[model samples]
Target: MAEPELIKYRSATGRWVLLATVLGTSLAFIDATVVNIALPEIGRGLSAEAAGLQWTVNGYALSLASLILLGGSLGDRFGRKRVFMIGIGWFAVASLLCGLAPNIELLIGARVLQGIGGALLTPGALAILEASFVRDDRARAIGAWSGLGGIGGALGPFLGGWLVEAGSWRYIFLINVPVAAFVLWVAAKHVPESRNPSAARRIDVAGVLTGAVGLGGLTYGFTAWPMRGPGDPVVLISLAVGVVGLVAFVLVERSSPQPMVPLRIFRTVAFAGANLVTLLVYAANGGVFFLVVINLQVVAGFTPLASGIAMLPVTVLMLLLSSRSGALGQRIGPRIPMTAGPLVCAVALVLMSMIGPDASYLTDVLPGVVIFGLGLSLLVAPLTSTALGSLDDAYAGIASGVNNAVARAAGLLSVAILPLAAGLGAGSLTVSDQLHPVYRHALLICAGLMAAGSVIAFFLIPNRLAAHAPADTFCDPCSPPLRPADTVRSAR
Candidate 1:
């Protein structure tokens, strides 16, 4: 079959394609951090314990992280538009289920289903753009997509908080339904269908299953650890299973002809270093995004709306400075930005740790948030560029996929493990006295993680990326780049 002709970025079809992809991707991106703002309310409304709330967050991440690579491969094998629309429709249904869920268990289950849909669509959004746009115009289209999607991310917390305060926490999930429906309609009507003709026919079933089991087991074990001590047999078994499953996943990937994760890519020192930094940085990020809003509301005596808006400075800073930061990195090299950015974030985390009862937003929160935002604005682009640039062009898609999965998994594991490490006992997240100390401890731990990441970046990442690396790979600090242009060819 002859491939569809590429379109210009300025055309009406291009505009519609960009709009559909941006909105489609936003459904997943916004849902990620937005739910954190509504976590306290969700807990209260559903009578959920801390473990239940943690699962509510991690469940979505677990499925998304595990299946995202597979999702990309499926899109390439079948059709990008077909899989993307299916993901949109599936996500909408799951969101409806989430809104109507009668109990915490059902809500968590619905969230897991929601993540499956997210995994399906997230990669396809950028892949579609890469396939549909003319090569010369692809960068601008992706840049616009990144910037506009950042706006959705910036609005997420404020929107989620308002919805929770004005009505119910359920509205946060319910709202995706109409937006998704519109996206579906636009996609079906105007989006061109494309797939990788050379994509592998056989799916990596073993790799997918093992990876899912590994992440699921670890997330479950840690999430259950706070309520059930590590000494518990179930905890021990789950941990063991998680360890075993991850090892098995590695083995399977090593042997598979078309692995979801090409284990060989880790041979590049720069690629490996970049991902390590991603792991530590994103783990810290997960802790902050998960706990900060709850801390503001529960301990600092702010309303949901107030707490949600507190972090706006971070988003704004990233929006304004990310592209410039990417340019700076390109000129001076990524090493300095990557090294210094996390150090700045560590300092910000230390400041954030000081927020306590009666803390003023301006005096206590805003300063830390601003510093954190600046650090992220500096860090994300270079880190993403380095990750993609460290590898050959052929491995770009897999590298992006690997880095993204690492970030998501880091967040997932951090959400599960941070509370346990901080000595947060069962049912303590709501109590000011109980949560305050835990929050402080957790933020300090997160600070240490950021600091560690900086050290890794200093030692491991190179001053310059490969000569052939994409020149324009900037992305929103809130989410990693879905697929950078010139890096979108299927890794398979």
Candidate 2:
């Protein structure tokens, strides 16, 4: 059969549109990891206190994590393209504001605005891809998209660090301006919008508010912990309130007419398991990254560029192999790679734990990076494919959004949990002595998370690829909400 005409693009326009979406998405993805390198410069420039510095980053993360599902849900309510372009535009403006900020207070505020843009832009691209391609081509498309982000993640620190060291931290934010503007223009022209048929399933206002409040409150408390030394009553109070809010949000979502999270989605074992693995894996990634950057610069006395470059091998390998992993996983199944990736990554973390500050990069860091990179390359594509493949076009945005939000929240939770756990003075002893144990301990903790992820993926995820089903199979007469995305159709 001939391929559908709508799915095809003028080769040049198609490539360009793909490029712009990549740029739009990468801006959020890389910035989240890259900005950690600039924190010292930002802190010095703004006379930022410890808490202020934490907020500068965590504020954006929290907003992104909390509001993401709603952001995707909103795209479905309006139009994917409509919400996406608005998000990129907002992100650009926020970047400008972040660059122009007079103090840490204002900088943190602008960062939160930036997070709002990220929430909007990310899911629309994923939804558009699902609508744009057939099941066979969909994995390839998502793999390519994720590969671009993996590359950006690898390159970000080196580029961001160089700019910070040569000039000011302002340059890091400034660089995003042209990138965002270009994406906004291309997205406005090329992207098509899609949504669920039931328009009456209006955006969930109460669910959105509760989720945002819960995440925001939790992040605020965590941000305060380092400054308050974790034991302060005010910090404790914030933590208590945040936990209560999250529980309350969960209950609210279960009852809302158009639930932001739609607890029903978890009925598919694959969908549920993949999201769980996403959370744990991303958390490990976040925690390890935070510790590595600090160890490289603060402990080893590397320049900013040096710190950024340290991540190159891991990022490069992941970018190169991610698509292959998806292709292979499609041929066989995700069971081996998904479970193995985290398991291998866990072993790599264990190796990383052994590195002393004085440890040679070749002997200590490079080996760990290669192992971790290969494992992640295998995991990302398959997990992403399976997660979205389980759903229909209509629910794609929010489905992807929920997983993405969970990933971001995992990172935020790591940011909140790791530093305090690591005892941040990593400069205490000689470079090797001080950093060695810190790296070891942090990596070991990540290993534990990965081990858990491996088990969850093994048991919870079934042993087959997901496919879209037909109307006859839809909802089984009285099934609530929508059909489980992973249900198999009659093999017609």
Candidate 3:
């Protein structure tokens, strides 16, 4: 297979392409966190169980995590721009349906649809950016994308809280409609199409089905087990099916000629280590975001608006520093920052666990939030750069997709299992005193996970400059070196 000639997009063209990817991916990132702030409101409105509320979040994440690899492969085979536009359209429609849903079941179903759309656009956005820019510009472009995307995520809780307090939680989904429309228009008008010419064109339907079924069953089992007793037939059946399906997926992937997730990438120590760290760190991160907001609102007597703005420290830090961190990671390599960042976050989480039911935000919460935010600012950009940087450009889409899926899966499982693990099962979510202990336990557990991540990074994440002895030797020898100017298959 011949490498496709890369096109150097003009400065103006790069700006538009960046705009579209940032906005397109932001739709998914924002939606992921925004809904968390509204969960309390939605639960109240719908008279939903804790498990039902969990499902509303996990259902979307499950679908997105399961299908994202396939989505990336599709973009690599088909045109990335075309697939991205289709995803945006699909997401917009699903958002509309979510806003209109009157019951928890319908809303969860709609959210699942939304996740499918998100899976398509999310990886394609990163892949498109990677293909559009030359290696010299790629790091900077990704930095900007990461920083701006962090802002979108930071804004979600604030926006969702405002909506939930002033009007309805439905507006959270409705807001995406206009944003998606603008992204679709800009992308179609200005973005060029690109695909991996050497990638296999065949879709892995069996892989897709088994993966989805596996994720769906596991998410369902975990989420429902808290509400329905562990002994319930539904819980037992779902867990059994989920385990079987996941095992089957591994077998199928092993046998398939062109698997969606090529098992060979795991052979790269840096790649595998980065993803392993991703799983642990994000699991902790997800538990904090999902549980902290709800705990603040329900236990601490915070209003929706206050709860939403409480995490502003994280937003401020990321928006200000993530781009710089990305550049720093490029120069210094990812090992130091990745190792130190999670340890800082672990300390912050331990600090956060001290906030009791009658705690003050300034004395107890703000300090922890600030430290946690700083740790995150240090970690996220470098983590992303390292994971994708280690892979060949040809596998950029799938690589990004795999990492994204791991992060989502982490959040999905944490949201489902953490409350139960913390001993705040079924009827305890809304009670102030009951949730205080849960918050403490959950925060401590999260801290442990972050600490473990730090340990893993210390041992497994290689300092490529020191180890490989060449600045551009980050990728595998099988692929081309990461050069300043690399050709992409582009239809201008």
Model 2 agreement with the true structure over 256-361: per-residue lDDT tens digits: 8777677777887888889999989999998887777667766666666676677777778766887688777777777777898899899888877765545577
Give the top-scoring candidate (TM-score): 2
lDDT tens per residue, model 1, 386-407:
7766764434445555776788
> Could you give the candidate ranking by TM-score, starting with the highest?
2, 3, 1
Q: Write the per-residue lDDT of candidate 3 for residues 327-446, one digit (tens) a residue.
A: 677677788889999999999999988776666889878999999988988888778877776776667678788888788778767876888788876658778888889998999999
TM-score of 1: 0.79
User: Residue 91 lDDT in model 2?
Assistant: 90
lDDT of each: 0.80, 0.74, 0.80
